[model samples]
Target: MIVITAPTGNIGRPLLSQLLESAPAAGEELRVIVRDPARLPDTARGRVEVITGSHADAKVLDRAFEGADAVFWLVPPDASRPPHDGYSGFTRPAVQAFAAHGVGHVVGVSALGRGTPVADRAGLVTASLAMDDLIASSGVAYRALANPSFFENLLEEADSIRDKSVFTDVVDADRRAPLVAVADIAAVAAGLLLDRSWTGTDSVPVLGPQDLSPNDLARIMTEQLGRPIRYERQPLDELHTTLVGYGLDEEFVQGVVDMKRAKDQGLDAGVVRTPDTASPTTFEQWCAQILAPAVRS
Candidate 1:
């Protein structure tokens, strides 16, 4: 049996599709913990058992994790909530349920930078790493899908990019960092969840084909869209003010700032992309296939 959390999310949605397609031959039974049953497609709701509630709730987790052999865990981000409450606090209950319910394997969505200069200071990444530690302490074989920035992030700025041919960020325009596509992350998660050969806890780095700076990304977008695209570098302080003005809590705002600082200081730049870690999708490919369509719409 397999239990997945955040089934309606970017990674979980795709992962559920892959698992459902592959489960028949393996005779695997699948289930999901989703807050809203309506958010799930009718096809998915019919195919798997749905436990409708937040996975962070003890009773919800207990009901969802029972009789499950492997689980896909993702702690959803809530900006108004405290870091501990959103990340580690939520995982604590699910971790207890994992031990109590005898779930043997866990595949979690985490970030890269476990052992780096800014790992301790990178706000969101620091909390995510702490969540990984809590899960590992539970004695279940775990794999944390440690990923860099996702190509999907561009969608958040697609409207601005479409209107002005520009995207903005606090990271250095010249800082080349690993930018992965979430589909690659989902594919990796589905593969690990389906196989039980590995033991103990480990971090799987899912970097994209190559490191690309914001300028590089701009150039690619220009070619793909047939228009000049530019990257506007917003100062960290200004960006912090902007997010705060949007009603985000101070801690959440700080984490976003800290992550940009860490990325600018080369936290993601050091990761070596190889056949194992390198995903097939590239920035150009994602622009043409994914981002461009969203912009056009």
Candidate 2:
């Protein structure tokens, strides 16, 4: 049996779809811990067992982890609390449940910069790494998928791209770093969850095919979307002020600022993309396939 948390999220949704198609062939029974079962795809109904509730809840995880051989873990973002509480605190109960239920393996979604100089101070990434350590301490064979920024993040600026022909970020226009598609992350997670021959706790970096700067993204967007799109760099202080204005927790807002600063300082530049670490799907391809449609619609 394999249990998947956050099955309706960006990464979990695709991971669940892939597992639905492949797990049955491997004689694996699937289960999902979700807050709202009604949000699941029509194809998932009557196919996998559904455990309704937050996976962060001890009772929910206790039931979900029972009889489970492997688990696909992804924590949903919670900006109402500090980074540590949002990440590690939300995962503590599940860690205890993993030990009690003896779940053999786990694959978690995490960020890049594990051993880099900036890692310890990268706020949210630091908390996420600590969460990985907590899970690994449970004696489960764990693989934390260390990833960089997502191409999908640009989806948030769809309106800006469509109306103003511009997108904004805190990163420098010329700072090149790996960026990935969430679908590719899901593909990597599906492979690890299906084949559990690997043991021990380690991180798998899902660096995309190439490194891209904000300017490179703008150039690709301009070409793929058939328009003049430009990159606008937002000041770090302005980003923090904007997030705080939206009423997010002050500490959580600070976490975002710190993460952006670390990325600017090369937090995500630690990993070298190899065939093993590099995932398919280029930024230009994602623009044509995903972003273009979103902007047009």
Candidate 3:
């Protein structure tokens, strides 16, 4: 049996579908941990076992992990909490649950550029690496799907794009970084979960289609939507203040701002290409296929 947590989320939605499609052919069963089963799409209904639970609920996690041979683990970011403590609180319980359940394998969602000097620059990434290590030591077959930024992040600016003709980020205009589709991340995760042959603390980085600076991304969005869209680089100090005002800890906001600064300084350079591990989706393709229709309506 394969158990997937966060099965209704951006990555988990498609991932659950892929697992359902692949499970029948492989003669496997699937279980999905959802906080609310009724909120799941009709397509996902009756396709797999829906276990209601949060990652932190041990009793619920035990029930979901029961009889599960493999699991796709993901720690959703809690921006409300201190950034350094977010992943830790989420992953520790998961690790404990996995150990108790005797689950055989796990595929985890993680961030890129972990274990580098810039690792600490992104508190979230640093904490994720620690979580990966904890899972590895649990003696379970594990794959850490370290993905770069997701293009879906742009959706946060839908209203701004509609009213102001601009999208903003802390990244520099000319600093290119790999941006992946959550769908591609889901596909790679599904592939890992289905393949029992792969094992042990493997860090799989999904580079997406190619690298693009915010300026390049802005150009693509403008061309795709046939409008004049622009990139507005948010000031780090202002960004930090906004995040803090949003109820995040000051230290957490500072760490996030530091990460943005690291990106501006080209800290994500010298990436390794793993052409076969997984195929990635492009930002323009995602914009055309996913974002454009949503924005048009």
Candidate 4:
């Protein structure tokens, strides 16, 4: 049996579809834990077993992980909680469930930056790495899909991009890093979860097709959208203030700030692309396909 968590999220949603669509042909049992049963696709409800509840709840995981062979795990972000607590705390219950239920292989959504100079200081990355460690220590065959910044993140600023032709971030406009499509990330996870021939723990960095600076993305958007879209770097203090104003925890806000600073310092540049990590979606392609439709809407 294969179980998936966060089945309604950006990566998890797609991963669920991928698994369900392929499972029939491959003969794998697909089960998912979701807080909202209605959020699941109509095609999937009939095909896979659905366990409704937050995965963080040990009771929920206990039921979902029972007799499961492989599981896809991702700790969804909660801004109100500090990074340490948000990432670690959420995974703790699931870890206990993994052990008690005898789940064998686990695939987790995590970030890249395990070996960079700023690895220790990058807040979200640091927490994600810690998550990987905790899962690996569980003695399950684990593969942390260590991902870079996602191109889909730009959609969060869809209104700003549509109205002002500009978007804001803490990372420098010139900083170059591989931006992945979440589709590729899910694809990797679905592949890993289906086959259980491998064992042991490892990090699989899913870098996108190419590296592009924020300015470079702007240039592409200008051509694709027929508007002069631009990128702006907000001051770290300003970002911190805005986040805190939203009632976010101070430590979590700082972690976000530090993660951005680490990027500006070339933390993401530390990744080396190989065929395994280099996914096929480019920023330009994403802008043309994904961002374009969102802007038009």
Top candidate when judged by TM-score against the true structure: 2
Candidate 3 RMSD to the real structure: 1.5
TM-score of each: 0.98, 0.99, 0.95, 0.98
Rank list by lDDT: 2, 1, 4, 3
Better candidate number, 2 or 3, judged by TM-score: 2
Give the local distance difference test score of model 4: 0.90
Candidate no. 4 TM-score: 0.98
- Over 184-275, each residue of candidate 1 has an lDDT whose tens digit, in order, gives 99899988988889999999999999999999999999999989999999999999999999999899999888988888887776567889
The lDDT values for all models are: 0.90, 0.95, 0.81, 0.90
Better of 1 and 3 by TM-score: 1
Q: What are the per-residue Cα lDDT tens digits for candidate 3 across 141-201?
A: 8999887778898898888887787999988789887778898899988888888897667
Deviation in angstroms for 85 in model 4?
Answer: 1.1
Which runs of model 2 end up more than 4 angstroms from their true locations?
Answer: none
Best by lDDT: 2
Clash-forming residue pairs, model 2: none
Q: What does the lDDT read for residue 25 in candidate 4?
A: 87
